[model samples]
Target chain A: MEQKKLITYTAGHASVRKQLLLFWTFFIIGSFTIGGGYAMILMMKRYLVEQYHWLKDEEFYDMLAISQVTPGPIAVNMATFVGYTQGGVLGSVLATLGVSIPAVAVIIVIAVFFPGFKDNVWIQRFFAGVIVGVVAQIATIVLDMGKRQKWTTISVIVCAGSLGVLFFVQQVSPIWLILGGGLVGLAVEALKPKSAGGASS
Target chain B: MSFLALFGVFFKIGIFTFGGGQAMIPLLQKDLVVNLAWVSMKEFLDFVAISEITPGPVAINMATFVGYKLRGLTGALVTSLGVILPSFIIILIVATVAHTFRTNLWVSAFLDGLQPVVLALLTYAVYSIAMGGIPAWWGYVAALGILLLILKYGKRLNLFLVLLAAGGLGLLMFR
Candidate 1:
């Protein structure tokens, strides 16, 4: 009989012969995740649009949009889902580390010696600029998501209505805001004609 | 709690926290502040403010600040490391094996669906921040202006200037 495909690992096919492989894999994954949160964001953007071609700019925006609203960093959450989907928990950890290693090394070094770097006003100024760049990047993601999802009158209504209820009115909580959106999504999808079900936009 | 216990607890938080630092705010508030009574509401608010104002992961800042407030500098370091340790350890584990895992199709679809929702939440967050942080009509106008400039020029625009400019404008108009 053929061997059964056991769910041996949450990520990667961690074989019995190569336990060392798993440890090294884990270490590298963890290190990278701690390091490269931002790089992962950019990389994910590229992967969706260019490599897999699974996500157009809008779908990429959708990925980014949901990633932002949920828990953890965008990199960790999205990467985890991707990794876990691939390899399980092990895969999740790998993607997490791949994204994080650069940041951990840099941040630890910075944290350890930030006192020394503290006096440099120019560095602070540069960081301030980095902040603006980060904001713009995040904003771009939002706009892209809107465009990608092809925010129809209804989606736009949901967006505005959610905004109003969330910020302006304050009757419902964010939990509800999300739930409401999901409901709206189900409704919208239901309303669409069955023939053109490829809501690709 | 023992140092190790504290380390373990924050480690769990670090590993589990999704949707960035802000997403964990309510749970952190409830567990540490409300239920456990590890911190007071005022102290929690102070930590929240500091985390938001400072750069880096908002959760890390809170962990450090709360640890320091509760014990001392050692507490700060321990808590900070604890918060990141799980992620650090796990990422290292995953990195070496990721290339092999990248091709799994089942893992891909779930992530696909989640992405759109996450983005929507963020857009909502931006709105929330604007409502709470902006504090004026001019503030809203400044946000729009900054957004426009960012779209046009991209990262070429300096964020420090943007923030300072926004703050300066806030001071000029509000004060």
Candidate 2:
């Protein structure tokens, strides 16, 4: 009976062990990551795409795009998607927990013991410096994505136009910008010839 | 605040926040720090800084930190759950349907459209953070150095190590 059950469950795709490995992988990545979700994307690319070959480059970029458009943290959204792809609902839960546990553990310790930690002068200076680094990291992602997209005319126009509105308009929600971009994409696709429209430039 | 109130507030934060973790700051400040007086503005700023430096989503870290401040481990559990619950449910639903519709032209086009906008949003993030003003010359130097280093050797070097090095340099120069 046990052998039969095992065979039934193991017909194809991820097994329990693979799910556990996925959990641990995210746990370690979540623990060490600094900066923010964008930073985590870099780490994910290194491990998931380059090291393990779990996801191809295009797949990773697609995931990144989906996570961005979704609500909540990009990292959490990504964890959910990746986990679901690998091992369904249970995998999603475990992966989310794995990524979150380290943060909760570390923060709880700091809150309990070093309540006044931020008041330290040296820590403040260090954060100031780190902020600069964070900015640089984000800039790198922007440039990297630009290169990957090959900076088509429409893409460049959309990028610059969005930036201009955000910079000049003040208080315009990014959601509108996102929606407008979608509309523009659809409109462009509708207008273009059948063959050209199908390809994402 | 009651645990239910805590959960409710965080759940609202989770669903509404878009463009990722940093974008949630204003909403958090408005609701928790400014209006509710749960934390002071200075404390909120400190939390933001701490959230960024730590190893997690800024929103999640903020929820956990604030919850711990308000009510210890239980509060942390509740608030974090509150924040995560919405996203978990939403993503689960989307994931279930998304795989089925992966080849749908409309869906693909929507995602494609979102790409450039997401890129723009990321660029804006860089701009806003830099606008915080570089107080010292070292800050600029550090920022440029990090940019160059990452551009050159990012694939080989661990980001955490670079961050640590930046912290050390900050201590030496800024402190």
lDDT of each: 0.51, 0.77
- TM-score of every model? 0.57, 0.88
Sequence-dependent TM-score of model 2:
0.88
The sequence of per-residue lDDT tens digits that candidate 2 reaches over residues A1-201 is: 111111011111478898898799889778877767876776777777887777776667777877776788888888887777777888888888888888788788878898777678887767676667777777787777878774668877988999999899978877788888878777765776665232432
| TM-score of chain A by itself in each prediction | 0.59, 0.82
Clash pairs, model 2 backbone: none
Specify the highest-DockQ model's number. Answer: 2
Q: Which ten residues in a row have the lowest lDDT in candidate 1 chain A?
A: A1-10
Docking class of 1: incorrect
| Residue A130 local lDDT, model 1 | 33
Top candidate on lDDT is 2
Candidate 1 on B14-128: residue-level lDDT in tens? 7666546555677678778876688899867755653554444556666776666566667766777677655545544543453432133223233333334445555665555
Global CA lDDT computed for model 2: 0.77
